[model samples]
Target: MFSEERRQEIYTIIREQKKVKVAQLAEKFSVTLETIRSDLKYLEGEGLIKRCHGGAILGKQEIKKISKFSDSFDISCLLHDLLIVRERKDRKPEGKVCVLGSFVVDIIANVDSFPKVGELINSKSNSIGPGGKGTNQAMAASFSDAKVHLITKVGEDHFSKYAYKYLQESGIDSFTIFQTEIEPTGSSISYLADKTQNNITATYLGANNTFSEQEIDISLPYVSEADVLLLQGEINIEANIKAAMFAKSVNKIIVLNVAPYSEDLKQLYATLDFITLNANQASHWADIEINDINDATQAINVISGDENKKVIIYMDELGVVYFDGRATFHIPPMPSLRVDTMAATDAFNGAFASKIAAGGTMHESVLFASAFLSAFIEQKGVTAMPVLSQVQARLKSRLEDIRPQIICNEKRCI
Candidate 1:
């Protein structure tokens, strides 16, 4: 058998038995002792198993322990401590998700070159469509075959009408969208330089940033109903924090996609079940310069803060780095001709949440998200989320691997 297959078999054995001797593996696989040792070494190196003198043991996931001094009155953290002791409902990884985030209409303008300050310039092309980190992420999860319920706000205007129309047909299982008459619908101006394809977006908070405790309380049912709650930095921090605290109370998995780097989220959001962010956000969060893997590692370690945190860092068009407290793995970029890079982060975040909800291991979820990303980016807009076949094809051709098709809601997947 190939080495990869052999290693996988050995890994299974160690996982089932919790320990295995080198000699036993060699005899079982009809391989030499050296081969068995090599397999054990590789598995240990991959953090799947722990090598010992004459055998290996399955690696244990070291969950960070909540301090005893933590107040019992702090019900959320107290409940979370209890949560780790019980069996979670979403073991199949195909569970429901609730996204407490924002949706904005994106106005993208392309230019030959960035104009000088205050100098008027003409655009080569322009387009308007549905785009927002939250909207994109929820769509990705829906496309990944997860049943998603999005909780957000929009203005009571023409844009709001489009928002309602879009979500009504967007395949997201449900949405608790609030229409505020005071503020205009959330919107952004994106300038894309022709040469570099680089972009700068300025967003008007509008109704997106007006979430209140009352609204969050109203959305509590969706928060409690979902197996996983996905959050981002784009929404109102106070409201999202309350939503998160509620999710924690009910033992839901919390995943934060930190973007637009906010100082308030640095300490609190990092403690979530999964925290995924791009390199720029990581640099700001960890207060470290991240130019390469080593630099990224330092930033991850700093953000991890000596806990067994599941932290992932993405460098656009470069690759994804996942640090699981103990070790870090570098997942290579999914090769694709970059089109609109606007929603890549949201795509990955949403896909990752779906896979995690489906009970895939962190590595497997990363692989799945990586494949989804390659498929998502080849297209131009967030609404251009590829179907299962397209993602499966990307998994076959681009990622060079295939797994069971993720199916949910009778017609969606990752």
Candidate 2:
């Protein structure tokens, strides 16, 4: 991929000469004609240049060579466009993702029993981990090889710095993060009981609750620049609504996950490109009685009126049901152990949105998301997300592994 600087350089030469030969560009850039040809093709697609016989000329819509520093906004726009073109141009940045929601420090512990008045329960162990809906989803998108940016607020303390550092190392771009003065960072305290069900969670909103309209306005450029913007309901209801509206204003696809359901979800649903929620959350958001997949489908159908908005009802083991317009389908969950249900929905949306940005259709996106979540749930924590290749490989292998079983079942029918 040609650097935006280099692309600007080529544009400069083309502007000065009005016409330039491929060999000359190759010489000036100290590269091969093939490389110059590739660059010219990119510029041409951008409506920047016209390739002539053995040479190229400025296109009908001429662009002045703008300075890198002077045209910062324009340059940023070009860089973003170039990023998209580069993905299509050759191999490019995997897509840009914006994750808006909770950034929490998860404190996991194993305890004997609930402490009675003066009685104490022995604490087996404790570990501090970064776990938040926004960060987790951003991580999943990154693991799937997308260029993700997390738009979250955290305290101006050690936890915030640590969160920023963690995200930076994981390939999430740090430029899009928002840091505010303390009001402590958000957190969750979980305690496991025996080896079965657990008693967990008292979360601190901290700076997460302070996400203001001003901050959201400032973050709009990133949102608008992104191919997809994922919204989590961890922030203020007004903020979520504004962010969804902002995304819609810019024509960026919005994927809203109404987890931890809220009273204002109906207002939110009409703005989303896709809405993902577990059976419980879906049932609650749609305000209908949903006991099974069929009921869930009917509920979604009623709420998603005119088929204008798409809905993805996540039915745990039964899989995910998708309805957009007249089309309705379900992608069944893969057979895998469910160790931790936390972040599973985030994994689904992250992978699903990433796939869509990577040029996958609705069906492909949902299936890929379902496959990723199945593998994700089988693992324990945040780092459990599989790569795009790994998910695809697992999907392929699973199919092959089941071929024999399919044949046996078919034989029984025969």
What TM-score would each prediction reach against the true structure?
Answer: 0.72, 0.69
Candidate 2 residue 265 Cα shift, in angstroms, is: 3.2
Tens-digit per-residue lDDT, 149-234, candidate 1:
88878887889868866775677766767766678889999988867767888988789888878778878988888889999988
Q: In model 1, where is the ten-residue run with the lowest total lDDT? A: 405-414
lDDT at position 103, candidate 1: 86
lDDT for each residue of candidate 2 in 1-414, tens digit (9 for 90 to 100): 123435656767776688999998788656688978888887776777789899899877645433433333244434432222212122245677888887899887766665678987778877788878888887777667676767777786788767755554555553344556647778888775545523556777788878777778867877877899888777778778888888888888888888667777667766788877878887786677777766777766665666357778888767777775545665666788767666678888888888877777777777778778878877776666765677878777775322211111111111
The root-mean-square deviation over C-alpha atoms between each candidate and the true structure, in angstroms, is: 23.6, 13.5
Residue pairs with clashing backbones, model 2: none
lDDT of each: 0.75, 0.70
Output the TM-score of candidate 2.
0.69
Q: Which is the leading candidate under lDDT?
A: 1
